[model samples]
Target: MPGFTKHMYLNDLNKIKSDFSNYIKNIIQILSEEYNLDSIMYILEKYYPYECQILNEKYDYYCLKDKKLIPLNKKVRYLMPKPKSIIRGLKITKKILSKTYKDNYALNFDKNLQLENEELLKKEREPKINKIKEKIDKAKLKAQEVEPSFLDELMGLYERKRTTQKDKVYIFKELEKYYCLKVISFF
Candidate 1:
């Protein structure tokens, strides 16, 4: 409590998980049936912000890893306590003078401790990183595949002649004319 006073006794400030990414698979299910592109984009946008926040927090945590974060005292001496205990009506000064209480001191950053802690943190982050990667890879595979419905016929035409964009457009136009049908250009 003396060292880490933020939010009372909290030590680590790292966020455990992304606020929005937990339901991305469900979001995808409700979107495109084939590519699920809308869901994929949702995951990307939400995941990126969470990644950035995590990176920022990690940066701040290691910012002073190699530098001194607390100043060391030139001499150790306890300032006499003057306040009276509320219930006992007696001075609460003995603890400060105790050897055990006085032994605590701050110093330059400990590189060994930092490395040990960093290794442990990497272990904690590994599974989350792997899970996100798997999710993104799955989304990539879905986005790359052809959609069904009307797109299947369109893609069938597209697949027959896998040529350059210009050639494909020309070929499709030629097919349109040969079939005596008007081709609508979505572009």
Candidate 2:
């Protein structure tokens, strides 16, 4: 009921009508083929089993109640039934086809609604995400603009002293005391 509205039902019925039209056109095309009655019967029996059943049962009841061998070609008109039987068959087929389409449409409708909601949420969050990104960028830029502190310079010097000259360990040991005093004074 969520996705199945009156408009949807009407649209589905229109589509089924078009599909039935195409089906009738195909049936006419098949009948127009130069195949024999046996081949025709085979095709009808294979595809339009319900129609064939109606035709056989009705014709037997109406025309061939007593007779055993009812002429296949003449007893029935084009291996199809009268208007009433054809309409009944179409109604049944339409009900089935419409139900199938409605079920499939309902399933897809939920997925589509979820996808739309996800997209909307993404859109709504985009500005906040951009603001956060902008703030982060400004922080990075501010950090870059600020000069290095004495502690950072001292750390750099210590690293260079360790890598460049292992024998200059005594010199760095003396500088370490001065560096610690400077750090304490600054803080």
Q: Give a tens-digit lDDT track for model 1, residues 74-152.
A: 2322221211111012122233223543343123335566456546545655677778889867755644243334543
lDDT of 2: 0.45
Steric collisions counted per model: 0, 0
Off by over 4 Å in 2: 1-109, 145-149, 152-187
The number of residue pairs in model 2 that clash at the backbone is 0
TM-score of 2: 0.22
Per-residue lDDT tens digits of candidate 2, residues 36-129? 3344345444444554554455444433322423544334312324433443356533453355644654555554554565466446545755
CA displacement after TM-score superposition, residue 4 of candidate 1 (Å): 38
lDDT of 1 at 43: 39
RMSD of each: 26.0, 35.1
**Which candidate number would show the highest TM-score if scored against the true structure?**
1
